[model samples]
Target: MDKRNQSTVTEFLLLGFGDLHNFKILVFTLFMTVHIMALTSNVLVIVLVGVTQSLHSPMYFFLSQLSLCEIVFTSNIVPTMLWLILVGHGKVSVAQCLYQFYFLGAPVIAQCLLLAAMSFDRHVAICRPLHYVTIMTFTNQLQMVTSCWFVGFTLTFFIYIFLRKLRFCDLNTINHFFCDVAPLLRLSCSSTTSVELTTAMVSFLVILSPFIFIVATYISIIHTILKIPSTSGRHKAFSTCSSHLIIVCTYYGTLSSIYIVPPRDNSINMNKGLSVLYTLVTPLFNPLIYCLRNQDIRNAVYKYIQSFRRRKVVL
Candidate 1:
């Protein structure tokens, strides 16, 4: 730890999937396709929610926010990943790496809070139908969304501050595709105990707390659904929040595997694989699941397509 022995690392070399040299082209094509599809789907969701009057409920509002997060989340990391795959390894300045971490981390934390807020929205709609309108006012929705973004960025800023304090020595190779905290910490010659501890505490608050809230909210939702006297009523109630539930499961399942679970001796590759699930696959599937399962989204999409077709015919 002596200053005399330390060499400043101005840039980092990301060793992104370089071992897969045989599948370089395949990996590049796959990542590019997923990135484009995730972006397109999230954008479509945002557009449909914005333009379609019938889709302007509190639920759809949160869905639009979630899509926006997905767009930011995937775009921040995937392009760099694609470049790394193509080049075998990519060089990035220390500042650029920290910026990447902030952008990527903020949206992830935002999405966690957003999902929790969405669960609360579903809870109000289902458990207190009569008060749903009064409870989920436009002002309230804005407050919830604002709080999510505010807390997300604020929490990540602290982590960024901690990261900036740690000095990297001569070793500047990041084993992962992106500037993830784990990889950067691995390369740092300075002590990372404080950074690791702060990250752990923040993860517990952002990830685990929201997940626990979502679970408790769903339990209440299910209890209310089961009490419905008519079978059709129960089915209808379940359908309303089912899409969000699916997304919650998929998002949290992959996320917990990577962050919550302890890493094993050969867990780097496994972590990368799990990272793909949450970062790439989850975003790609979110809008698809919602559109397929939610009647309102489908109707809005169908109506838009019909309108487009009619305009084409007129032209």
Candidate 2:
């Protein structure tokens, strides 16, 4: 409103799980364990894909990129969350909060596009098997990954610009773990209608569009699998993309719950819980899912372990 009445808020107090008054230490321990596990698992995937010769296909290349995104996405929020859980609250300057938001959004948005690209890779491999090699060349794969990161960061940068324009007066407390767009918009004194509109457009572009593409891609894949007369043929075809399908379901399901579904009476708590699914649980489970389900990844891990053991014995 009036300039004289407004007090600039240089920082925000993140009230993360503050209600766990008697269980702060327990919660902190749990969060710390998950954070460490998630980082380790994702890093392992990246390393395996890079060093293993058999794992250098387009599929594994995309999986490595996905792991990289998970590493960035989880690391951006979980450390702050652990600190907040330990201390009951934490202060983040305005610039720092915006930076946090940017890092958070960029990886997620990039991952969304990457997932879609992965699905397309699967579709080509199964539905158009003859053309798979020529279509999914190293150059094409690099271009796809580059575009995902570029578009993801560029779109989020615009949202950050809009967020910076809003004035925060007096109110400096965030209910959620990190600086999410919803809580920040609520605390802004300036009109957020335009910002919300811009966010909506970007969400559609980055989230909804990619999800739809993945869905359509899977439909074709299923159709192709069904046309195969032999049962083993169908199974083989299905197995190729099943890991990606599971991840797509988990990722989009949690996202839809948090953002697309209508909020209920306990929406704030519900949102927080669902946020944990995508932000923490999904990343932690991703590499696990791929490792358990994909035979190549399993073999790679086994070979790497064997090699390490042999080297140790020699030394």
Candidate 3:
């Protein structure tokens, strides 16, 4: 089949985390637990936020969207991984591989914009309290979310389209656990100029743009936090933002290290290991960070669990 006209790739073989002498099964079980915990925790946060009227604020709204993205992100990668690990088969067609790439990457890019937007929301809420409602209005927030989705999927779709034009006659075996750009590019037989350039452009725009904005917002936030007169007041405000900051830093730092930094070639396993943190670990933490650190969510979860037990006892 001609490269430009090619529509099918017979099959793809994913070389997962790596060959463990006898520990691959353990790794599989570990990820299975993560999937369950991630799903349950994020769902609970969504439930708590949706049902509780008090939780209907810009911060929580951003959290809600973050939870949604984390859920979609985890769902995209984990089920396929589980199927592969359990069945000892990670074979995928070109279509399936591309689909997985789109589904996974779009949310990830969207999430970057979403987090930057959330930082802005926090900045306004904390630093410009009087105008918070006016600045972060329902319409404005919706527009932001929509913009994130647009930017995210647009990059993902373009990358896929560009890659589709190239021929992969050299190597068919994927080195990483997931369909990452660099690893996949290693397999191409045609000129990688377009793919590499496009990927670099997209990555620079997506990662760097949001990162700069987020850092600016946080700098302003810290300045404002320092200006507070009362220690208690500062503590309370910092407490609210601290968990979000932790989650944000963990996500972005590891992701930047993985994609932006040049792969050492020898430490490809380190790259895959870091990928697991973003893909598997973040989903598990998103809900816990929001709920455990948030009183409204904690209260709602407590009530929901109690009510369920009561109903069960009555039955």
Candidate 4:
């Protein structure tokens, strides 16, 4: 093939877990189980929030948005992976790969920012209780959710511009399961240093900035909690923030390890494991955390179940 022809790759082969060929069925089963579970849990949260009038608060509103994002995020990547595992080989067109990357990137960014917004919500509720209702009204919550989605979708253009310019040459096989930025960059024949640096910088700014803001907001929340004279008041304040804190810790901790911190090994397998943590595990856990830990959510869910039973009996 001529150099020009070699540089042009119309499609990409998703080389997903080629080493696991012997256990492909096992892998497929595991992934399918997790994917189904993640989807079911997140969707349940969304439905519960929608139907339960008591859950119409700003916090639950954000939780529902997060659940929706999780649904979209996992759907974009997991089904393709299942198909590839079942069929043995999967080819994705250049356009398809780019769209996959865009879809994945946008929600991940939006979720990060949403976590920050959730933290700010907690901050307002705890530290500035008197002004919480005024500050985090439905209109403000809607604007915040919209802003997170908008910024996440808009920011992809920066990385995608450079990503689109890269020539694949003869390398058209994506090492990882999905069309992740790191794996895609590895397949490019050209030097991706600038693109890599740009990506790293963008990720740091987008992720770390919100993370820092969340930390500061929590500090203020903590300070306020300590000042509360009654133990019950302090417990109430802590309970409100705990789920968000756990999520922040899990999401950002895995995220920073993958993107922000210096990588210990840039191996495909290593990245795959880290990717699973954030992409699959985190989404699965979010709804479980909220439903199990938060008394309000649990009560609402219980009430919903009772109502459902009562309606079924009547019918």
lDDT of 4 at 43: 92
lDDT of 3 at 268: 77
Best by lDDT: 1
Candidate 2, residues 1-315, lDDT tens digits: the string is 577988999999999877687788887788788888989999999999999899999999999999999999988988888888788888999999999999999998999999999999999999898999899999999999999999989999999999999999999999889998888998999899888998989988988999999989999999989999999999999988889999999998898787667667668877888887777788999999999999999999999899999999999
Ordered by TM-score, highest first, the candidates read 1, 2, 4, 3
Q: Candidate 3 — what's its lDDT? A: 0.82
Q: Residue 47 CA error for candidate 2 (Å)?
A: 0.6
Q: Please state the error at residue 31 of candidate 3 in Å.
A: 1.1
- Candidate 3 segments exceeding 4 Å error: 1-9, 87-89
In model 3, pairs of residues that clash are none
| Residue range 1-315, candidate 1, lDDT tens digits | 578988899999988886676898888888889889999999999999998899888999999999999999998998898888888888999999999999998999999999999999999988998999899999999999999999999999999999999989999988788898888888888899999999999999999999999999999999999999999999999998889899999988888898789888799888888887777899999999999998998899899899999999999
Clashing residue pairs in candidate 1 (N, C-alpha, C atoms within 3 angstroms): none
**Per-candidate TM-score against the hidden true structure:** 0.97, 0.97, 0.93, 0.93
Ranking by lDDT: 1, 2, 4, 3
lDDT of 4 by residue, 178-289 (tens): 8878777878887798788878777976799999999999989999999999999999889889999999999889888777766555455787788877777888999999
Local accuracy by lDDT, each model: 0.92, 0.91, 0.82, 0.87
- Which of candidates 1 and 2 is the stronger one according to lDDT? 1
